[model samples]
Target: MSGQRRTATRSEHALEDLDGAALSYAARFAEQSEGRRRDHLRDELVQLALPFAGRLARRYRGRGEPLEDLEQVARLGLVKAVDRYDPERGSFTAYAAVTITGEIKRHFRDRTWGVHVPRRLQDLTIEVSQATAVLTSELSRSPTVAELAARLETSEEDILAALESAAGYTPASLNGPVGDDGPAELGDMFGALDADLESVDDRLTVSGLLYRLPARERRILAMRFYGNYTQSDIAAEFGISQMHVSRLLSRTLTWLRQAMLTDTPPRWESTGAPPEPPDAVTVSVDRADGRVQVGIRGELDRSAAERVRCALVDVVCAAGTDEVLVDLDGVGFIDAAGIAALLASHEAARRAAVRLRIADPQPYVRRSLIVAGLAPLFT
Candidate 1:
């Protein structure tokens, strides 16, 4: 009894503190004009009432409503209550509680239903539910519709309608477990896949948008957007700074969004002349799904090393591929110059946060990399 009294006293003290804070904030709000100070006081006022609103929200939880979402709705309600509250009307705590509870109830009435139904049935469904649970506990079994009606002091017809409307509270999952004793799922009863796959249009749209970007840009987008990599993570991969990644991402996405709005080719693609082919090495860049494949077919010696290095670095940065597979199967040799190119590309990929790999290296090429002690780097 002593412990309970102490807890109650502590709660009372906390409430008093909150009330004092709120009144102070209100006084400050009235004194200030439209400025940062007034906004700050208003925010502090809302913060003070959030705890009370949270308690009110928890009362309406667990009927398939997410508590976090309810709390957010309740917080919004508290803000409204704090805005409209008058000290002359009643205590701020009582007024805020009523406002917050109304918001939560409004959430259930307007948004919680998975399927549309009559508003009267929707409200009665909640009443019927509460009555059913109480009667079930008292009788030690599920209550009949007639018993629920009697308990709720409603007609049997109204009880049946509300019970039927209860299905709108939660939509049944197609993949949910089915049958009392079997392992079958609800989806197992369905037929074959839909002939028109839903992802086709999305895939085509994304593919079209991605194709407009250079290989390095594509790889960056893939890493940042598709891979959910942070700017710092991408910077570490590409050996670039986080600021550079941020600018690159911002500019690229802005361009894409603008192009989408205008329904025209982006400025990069609008240039009259096509990009000149790399002179020293033959470079072919291809993107499928989210992967960028760069095929290099030629002797990777000093004469072609710089070209190869530049081509590779460009591809790694621009490809927008989750994983870059460099097909080195056609390469006949690799000297120090070629090794330098490989190392440079590898380091660049590391900084950009791109996945760079040497795919199907020929035996001679492998020996050259291994001999130069560079084999471990290209995986």
Candidate 2:
């Protein structure tokens, strides 16, 4: 995207003035019986059109089409525009711009913009469908962005962003509504009932819930989740810093926890979605339809130990659960309490008959467990 942006930017430089009188004189001579001047003028015009072709290509960035292909399509338009143009028509530049611009937009509408998506990103379309299925089953209500993120074991932001990316090539169109013969979308039957996720209370609860968070937090959630922005992109949008975005997002989580608790009650309480911990304890849990992965990063201070405990408990007890994977892949430090938390969670899983798996344990977490005299049990 950056490269495309740079290529487009190159077009905005100060205008290159062609000596029109000289060009027209040569063109007139070329127009006389079969001659070299017409071909030369046309070739020069094609070269001039190349930069516009590049700029138009960049505007549709992120639609999953290759830039080079779009440029070729645009150049095709430029060629057509150049062919129909007469030097006597206003400025040759203005005449060329109109026909070419229209062609570029039409080209995208037909070949790329909302039609093309790469294989990897196309797979995400399936992931979103599966996620929506899971969330609809669990949440009884339409899932919020935060809830969807929690279920997928990704940040709520990532799930929403993926949905937006998928929207561009949605195998359907938003500009057109469903058939007029049927009732409005929600009013239509979904398995004799309405499966439409947004039809739930018209998303009233989630929107109301968002109003409770701080404005900055609300903006972060909007940018990250809805607009498909990375943290860096969000940082750039607000004209602040990435660290600033990091800090703000941390605080946003704390506020979300508090607000949800105030509005709904215990449903989300005891959730792994606790207050954001310091860099001292970094935990990531990726919950998907078929499996649950729990990853812990950084040192777990004694105070931060419960964060890990509650997280393990949440997934281990989750319904339709498969396996609980403890990824100590990023753990470089640990304390006695952290070790105890793992052991307790493991035992709890045993009682429930939940499959508990620990993967590629990091050296530090391994050393801590061994020194604690618990290594023999797992081995």
Candidate 3:
């Protein structure tokens, strides 16, 4: 007990020394009149009082607000306190603590809540929180709602309502882990009736059909639909006849139709409009001297392939020229899908009986085309 008392005395002496240092800094800060000296003094005082602010901020940790963010808020409060503090009014520690707590409370009130809640409930929640902390200290246990109501001089119903609304302060993720060493999520505990299961059934049928296809065949489809590869490009990649690629694609598409017919695909409802396609490629057409020039920009990968293919086809088909020139000068990247898109465009140009020339491709793009055995076509 004597050793405990000695330790307590040392702690008290240490606190007193801290208070003396803070007070000295604050006096120096307040004495300077709007100069670098004043700024320097203010910095010194703020740095001195930062630990106090940090301690105040730590009170609200693990409530979803990151400790770092809370500390930032507290530091701002300390700066305000240092600027507004009057040594004549009160001790800097007490003033700074109040200011920092107010900042943290304001942070919750203004920013932390995920959903809208009433102003009265918000104020009461903060009040209840403060009362709970104080009561927990005084009683050595969490206070009951009745006890909380008594402390705050409010009804038990109001205390309960505030407690309920406390959930709005930090809305938890359904994906968050809860029980220790458990594989289940919060989402797993709940289920809602989905009226759209019929649509899901149709999608699953089509998805299963596609997934069941051979990897190479699926890749070809991806090149055609997702990668925007022409049948000719796909054929060249596989060292097969273009007619074979065309037949394979047609068979796959027919399978999709058969599955959809069996499943009775649902008509899209008007509750929401279809999403707009993303702008992954840009195309500009210039016609001059019995030739049409098409300028393409952006990465020509799987994502952009379909758009690029369509743009090339439309431009080439519409151009009443002996030669259609595709200028890929602005294109930065190209992939297998992009090569397929170009080959598809070439096929479309052939059907229209027009010459399609790939002109001024970037060095890497030209290298890719050459490697893909389409160098002669481009020249």
Best by TM-score: 1
**For residues 238-305, could you state the per-residue lDDT of candidate 3 as single tens digits?**
99999988877887677667657864323221213432222346889888887899998766878889
Would you estimate the TM-scores of all the predictions?
0.42, 0.27, 0.36
Candidate scoring better on lDDT of 2 and 3 = 3
The segments of candidate 1 whose C-alpha lies over 4 angstroms from its true place after superposition are 1-14, 137-143, 179-379
Give the runs in model 2 whose Cα sits over 4 Å from its true position: 1-15, 18-26, 35-37, 113-168, 172-379
Note the residue pairs that clash in candidate 2: 153-286, 153-287
Q: CA lDDT of 295 in candidate 2?
A: 82
Task: Report the number of clashing residue pairs per model.
Answer: 22, 2, 1
263-289: candidate 2 lDDT, tens digit per residue: 442222222345333335666878777
Two-way lDDT contest, 1 vs 2, winner: 1
Clash pairs (backbone) in predicted model 3: 223-229
RMSD of each: 24.6, 27.0, 17.7
Q: How much lDDT does each candidate structure score?
A: 0.79, 0.66, 0.80
Worst 10 residues of 3 by lDDT: 267-276
